[model samples]
Target: MADIIESAGVVLAYGVAGFAVMALGYLALDLVTPRRLSSLIWTERNVGAAIVMSGQMIGVGLVVAAAINASEFQRGLGVGLVSTLIYGLAGVIVMTLVFALVGILTPGRMGATVLEDRDGRPHPAAWVQGAMYIATAVMLTAALS
Candidate 1:
């Protein structure tokens, strides 16, 4: 019973820590982006922002999941936490680089392309960028896990 309780506490602690780490990843992405993502999504109701932000958050989550799956948290949750941070940050950084690379290859400026609209619709370039972000996450998660 005592061991079970201790294990439960560890899980809870790590779960919270994992979420905080993910939030930090989001902040990092927000800093890189030109527009305030929250304002664009909530205030402007920008579908482009919604898709891109959603992809970014999911990408970070996949990295955390991979870290948790790969690390032996039962041995030492502290070590597990550190591994999670390391792997998660790597995943975020890789995702960011993929986004930039895609944007560069894309005809127009990626940031501006994300905000571009045509005929009252979100531009196709934004969708492509979001897809690239998600695909990169999936690939990294597979390698990490």
Candidate 2:
């Protein structure tokens, strides 16, 4: 039916918008961290970096998911997309601030704590930071809900 096709188009548009926002969130994260995430995780085989990256990805995903689900798209596709973008950007900013503040509060340099590889052995702090990021995302999403 034409209605079904139109609905599908709307869904597709929403998905595209969400993913674009998520990519921007990742870029913001890349800017905040000292090391490049893709290299640290893929090339270096750094478990600690991977852990932190995982948390960040999930956190950003949560924000994107929340925005897509909660936005005023039902009012109209354009309105919904714009609202979702606004929410997603806000989430990214908030998460970045959380990361930065926590990084500062932690005892050592942020990069050192996150990319802790000594003789290829990972440090405990890396995991702790990862969990904190996840917790921040969870709390943020819940608050937004």
Clashes of 2: 0
Badly placed stretches (over 4 Å) of model 1 are 1-4, 118-120
Which candidate's lDDT is highest? 2
Model 2, 43-77: lDDT tens digits are 98988788777777788788778887888977989
lDDT of each: 0.79, 0.80
- Model 1 Cα lDDT, one tens digit per residue, 4-67: 9998997787787678767876777677678887888888888886778788888788778888
| Residue 63 shift from truth in candidate 2, angstroms | 1.4
Worst 10 residues of 1 by lDDT: 111-120
- Candidate 2 least-lDDT 10 residues: 125-134
